[model samples]
Target: MDFLTITLPISGVAINPLLLVLLGVAVGVLGGFFGMGGAWMVTPALNIFGFPMPFAVGTDLCHMAGKSIISTRRHAKFGNVDVKLGLIMLSFDVVGIEIGARAVMLLERFGLAGLVIRWVYVVFLALIGSLIFYDFIKKRQMDKSGGDQSKSAITWHETLHKIKIPPMVNLPMAGVQCSLWLPATVGFMVGLLAGFLGIGGGLLMMPALVYLIGCPTYVAVGTDLFTIMLAGFYGAFTYGMKGRIELLAVVIMLAGAAPGAMIGTIATKYIRGYGIRLMFGATVVCAMVSVILKQMGQGGAASWVIMTAVTLMTAIVAIGMFKGAARELRERRLSHEPR
Candidate 1:
């Protein structure tokens, strides 16, 4: 293990090369599959493996820039990326992030930044996770009862669209015509939370896109990656300037992330929108649990818990991807068979 370890340039910490690779693979799969940076999962995992806590966000963001571009390009090939929506969201995110960062700075002056942020994180994660899980369960029950799930899923977005605020925008790619304020407001909120929490906003943005902006599941994933790519680059540059980023570590992680991203992007071709939502819900719940444990001051236990959840979620998604891909291949083969 000692010989397998290497020191990162900026962080100046020795870590196993293999662990970096594996972490990249895990987050890459999630990011590509779900259009998230997976920083929520990656941050704690890095801390557990002895990475400096302060440097974790910078390193993760640095890697996320590369990973998101790879994933976004792959998704674009599938016609799932909504470039217009992504750009719109990106602009608002910049504003929100600044506001949120400034707010955090103010809180720090009062000596309450850490505790306040942690509690808010716990609340946001728990609430959002529960809502997603509820939606998943509700859809399942509807399916069992032969009710219409699609109608139910879009009800919330539809209501928001009905607000009829001025400057409504038409998102042809996403198949939505609604107030521009909808996505702008959503992006700002996600950015604010991300800035305050010091993590990639993808985890928050995806749900908002799906439930608030009425983007198709696949489109939401791809567009989120588009936004994350730009944001990641900004985050990396700022953090790198502070000497918190390890370029070598980022390169090693990207080595594993590249392949994982390919697999994840390809998997989208076989999986349905609802299937993606369910998997995302599971991961959010995992994050929620980890936050709760952390708030309770179980630092050691929380790290392991996060690792377990991420490992399990990644493995399950990988299995699903392979199984779906295999089934598709078999179906194609059967269709091509002569009578």
Candidate 2:
């Protein structure tokens, strides 16, 4: 056990390298499947495991930039990415990141970084998780009642699409026709959270793209990952300049994350629509519970809870991918039979 421990040069923390790799793998899977950088889990997990909050934020961002490149590429092959929409969001996202980074710095100056950020995570995760479940339940009721099954129970995006402000954009890829300001506004807010929470904004951005921008679930997943890549890179640079990034940890994590990301992205091809939303809701709730445990002075329990949550979610995604791939193969075989 002691033999596996390595000291991080920058952070001066001696931790098992295996933990870093495990976190990377989990992030990779969840990021690809959920279209996030998995920072919401990683930051708290890292902090729970020993890193300072600032270092956790910086290292997570650095690793996210690399992992997202892999996920984004895979999603594009499936025609899930809305390049125009992602590009539009990137500009505002960067500005929001800068503002968020500054806010983090200010909080650090007052020695309230960890406390404030953890509480924020609890609140944000609760809101997002609740909304997802509520939507899922509502949709299920509609299905039972023989109502319109194609529409989401929550129709916020419908209202947003009607804004029709000047300089509208038509995104054929995402099947969205709305004002450019819509994504810009969403991007800025997501970026702000990304910077403040070190989450790369995927947690909120994915839902926003689906619920507010009216992109299909898969398109939202891909586009959110695209924004995450840009946000992660900018966030890493900003945190690196501040001397908060742990390069050694980032490299170690990426070793596991790269492959895990591919698995998660491929899984998305099999698990569509509400399936992703339901699992994502569960993941968020698990993460929120872990954060709450940490805030309750139960660091060891928090670490176990978060790690277990990631492992379970990763297993579910991997299993879905295997089953889907097998089904496709069987279908192909049947279709090509001597008929």
Candidate 3:
């Protein structure tokens, strides 16, 4: 392993460069496809691979800043990004992050930070993953019965939008008209969770945008990336100032993440919105399992579980993307044939 190891300058720790690149690639796919930074996946994976918790969180955020830019550019080409919504959410999210960070600091003073954060992940991952999966099942059943599954009838989003409040705003791109406070509130809460957990916030924001703010799944993904870019920058700067960042490791990850994001973003054009939702739900469920394993003190087992699950999920998403693209190309060729 000596031949494969590289010493990180800031942290002065030896690590495998190959492992960093692979982690970046897997996370890049998840981020690009789901419009998330995948901190939930990356942080634990990093910890398993020898990064201290602070270093893992900091380096992940640093790479995410660049990875998100690549993915967001591709998503913008498809007109999937809602810039206004993203900006609004970013503003509220930043404030939430500060508050959440302070709260975590307070908990750390009492020696309860680790236990609290772990349980939070358990609760959040379980609740959100189950809801998304259930919705996927419901939609499938509705499709079989020839029932309508439009925005107006899709769970709590419709009900939330119906709330009569001051300062109503319309997001034509997201195809919703609701109070501006709606997104702000949701963004703040999600940001709080992200900051407290030292994550990128995408795991929570994707579902929030789709279910609470009533954005289309595709739009939710794109917008989430835009906001996550800002969050990453903030996280990177804060963690760097605290001397917790390993810049060299982050650079290695970015090398793979740049191209991986492009691949994942392009896949969006081939797959349907429902397909993205299903993948998102499945990945979250996997993350939940990984977090549970780690909480049990089975460090080696947890590491293997996360790496295996992430690799498998990324491969599945990649395959779905390729298959969908191939089918589209075939249809196009057929339509162009002499007839």
Candidate 4:
């Protein structure tokens, strides 16, 4: 065990590199499938493993930027990305990230960074998780009653689209027409969270694109990954300049994340729509419970809960990909047979 431990040169903390690789692989799959950077899971996991909040955030952002680039490219090939919409959101996202980074730095100075960040994670995760589950349940009820199946239970995007503000823009890929400010506003808010939480903004941005910006589920996933890549680059740079990042950890994580990301992005082609939403909601709920446990001084339980959730989700996504691939091969073989 002692031979497995290595001290991070910058952070001066000894940790098992294998653990970092494992976290990377799990998050890479979840992030690619869910259209997030998986910072929500990694930051907490790193903190539980003994890294300070700031270092955990910085290293996570650095690792996320690289993984997101891979996921975004894969999504683009599937015609899932809306480039125009992603670029528009990027403009405002960077500014919000800067503000958030500053806020975290201030909290660190006061020795309240860890406490404040953990509490915020609990609150934010609760809201997002609840909304996703509620929407999933409502959609199931609609299916049973033979109501319109196309409409989601939460229609905030519809109302927002109807606002008719000036400078309306059309996103053909996303099949959306709305005020230009709509996505920019959403970007700023999500970016704020990214900076403060060390996330790539994908956690919030994916749902925001679907529920607040009117993008289709697949398009939202791709576009969110695009935005996450750019935001992650800026975040990594910001944290790096502040001497918060551990390059050794980032490199180790990327080793596992690369292959895991490919599996996740492909799984989306099979899972589709509400399936993604359901898994995402479950992931959030698990993360929230783990954070709550950590706050209650159950550190070992918190670690187990989060790691178990990540491993399970990764397996689910990988299984879906394999099954979908096999089915496709069978259909292709049948098509080739002389009729």
Candidate 5:
């Protein structure tokens, strides 16, 4: 058992040491590569194991903010980040997270905030999962037809560009001209979801940046992290000011994730971008399924039924991605070796 300090009136909390470190590592890897709010795993695991909702969310936000700051800087240094695109993304993403946060507060008044969040996860998860899955399946068809395709296709981005709305913004990095209203509306919608789910919304943000906002895959991810860094920092400060942040847990997780982030970043250099996207899509899809089953259990379904389903899915995915990344890394090294 590992224990970590919490805010006043709570003192400290105990958790499984190995699991905590593992959580940091898994989230670090995904966040480093995917620019997501891995709070899906952290908050749920924390809540299930006994941490209060607010504390779990608060601490995770702080950790995410810190890690994002580091990751965004690293990506920027590597020329993977587009500051102008990131700045543009920040406007909408921040508005979305803040609006999302406010919605969470409103849902709290109704009770069933957890259940509502689960449903939100189900909807967003299903929608994004379908979209990602379709992309790969479409890739196969395109390949079979002998059509050359870019590494990351932008059919959706092009479709969006055709909409001739007034006051369109030319996002050169994204290579799309979208209406100002488009970003604001998307941001507000995402923000409402974030508030309701009490999440950083990275899982949704990255995909949105790519498909909806029309940024290149690498640029979208880097920009998403830059945007999420803002959300996390703001969320953390707000929670801390309200006396909800858990310093001890944040300290412990960061201690583990700092090294893990270094490893994740190094691994990123070796791993193919497509590989990362597939795994990122798979992870969130699994998480989405998990949240769905959790909702099923809440609706009086057999707890084990939902538990078994989610557990199997999560385990298979997490392990598969880990092994796949390791194998890819090995293959990349071999290819670079002196013949």
Candidate 6:
């Protein structure tokens, strides 16, 4: 495929057709499995493949909207989504995004904005991803020993839920009756980062929902997908109104991701909490590796072989997840009494 040029009133931007499809395929898998678009994968891929930074950001926002629609519709069908939480999150996301955008502009004046924003994104990704990784690891160890933690340890959600603040609101999906600040704070923080980086911030939101708000893994996947649905539409509309979006590319990506998302979302049903967390953590780790390679490439130490390595690593991770879930299902089937 050839790179297509989309001209805005200000300037024309070039987008690689092959890279867009590649991004759609990878994000579709991650999004369907965990309800996160892995826009952390999209934005960087766009930038590296030769789109101007602004266009890359804008176009990914458009693409994310379509993907989120497919994902949200699928997840919502599973009886896991919380509409109230999604609406509450929507209220502050706009405010956080605007303030976050202004902050980025201020950083840009000093020529340090891009570096600072990316470093911040990586830190958040690592911190949130590490927390999920730790929980899954702890649970795996306990399973091996036939022991379980009795909810007495300091989990981020447990700590936050313990605070006796006023105006406790209930989130059925999160299964918490804590202060409004808890949910709003988590959403606002992630929203701010998303606005600044032109990302969907599902990685940030999903973990915060699980650990910060005590949402179950499956439910958090649903809630996160629902909220991303709103953000994506708003983002794409804003960009499209400004004539900065490539609608053609977005349409093609959507055509693939829609059905892929349906299958990905269904796969979660056969998977356990630990299995989902393992895969989710593994996805972030793979995204991290992808980022590392892109960084090395920037430093002139990368090769096309690195992309192949990334693809292989990602495939192995997905297969490992699917196999783990299959084994669990098979064992459960074996343990059941015949009807």
TM-score per model over all chains: 0.94, 0.88, 0.91, 0.87, 0.78, 0.80
Please write out the lDDT profile of model 4 over residues 160-196, one tens digit for every residue. 9988878999998999999998988888888788779
Q: Identify the runs in model 6 with alpha carbons over 4 angstroms from their true place.
A: 1-22, 46-53, 149-154, 289-339
lDDT of each: 0.86, 0.89, 0.85, 0.89, 0.68, 0.70
- Tens-place lDDT digits, model 3, residues 1-339: 679888888787788898888888888887899999888778777777778998988888888998998899888888888998999888988889889999999999999999999999889999999888888888888888888766323578777878768898888789878888888888899889988986778889999999899888889999999988887898899998998888888889999898788768878877788888888888888778877887998777877777787888789878877887889899999999999
Candidate 3: pairs in clash: none
Shift of residue 40 alpha carbon in model 3, Å: 2.0
Looking at model 6, the pairs that clash are none
lDDT of 6: 0.70
Candidate 2 TM-score versus the reference: 0.88
lDDT of 5 by residue, 183-233 (tens): 666666666666567667777777777777677677677777788888788
- On a 0 to 1 TM-score scale, where does candidate 6 land against the true structure? 0.80
* lDDT of candidate 6 over 1-339, digit per residue (tens): 453534333434455555556667666766777877656656656667666766666777888877877777777778678888877776877777888899999999999986787677667667766877788777767767777544412277877888867777998765778888877877788788877875677877787777778877888888888887777778778877877676666776777666556656767776676677776776666555555555555533333433454355446545655776788889899889586
Query: What are the per-model C-alpha RMSD values against the true structure?
Result: 1.8, 2.8, 2.2, 2.9, 4.5, 4.6
* Candidate scoring better on lDDT of 1 and 5: 1
What lDDT does candidate 3 reach at residue 205? 93
Which digits, one per residue and each the tens of the lDDT, describe model 2 over residues 210-289? 88888999999998898788878988998999999999999999999988998899998888699999999998898889
Displacement of the residue 69 alpha carbon in candidate 6, Å: 1.8
lDDT of 1 by residue, 94-140 (tens): 89988999999999999999999988887887777777778778888
Whole-structure CA lDDT of model 2: 0.89
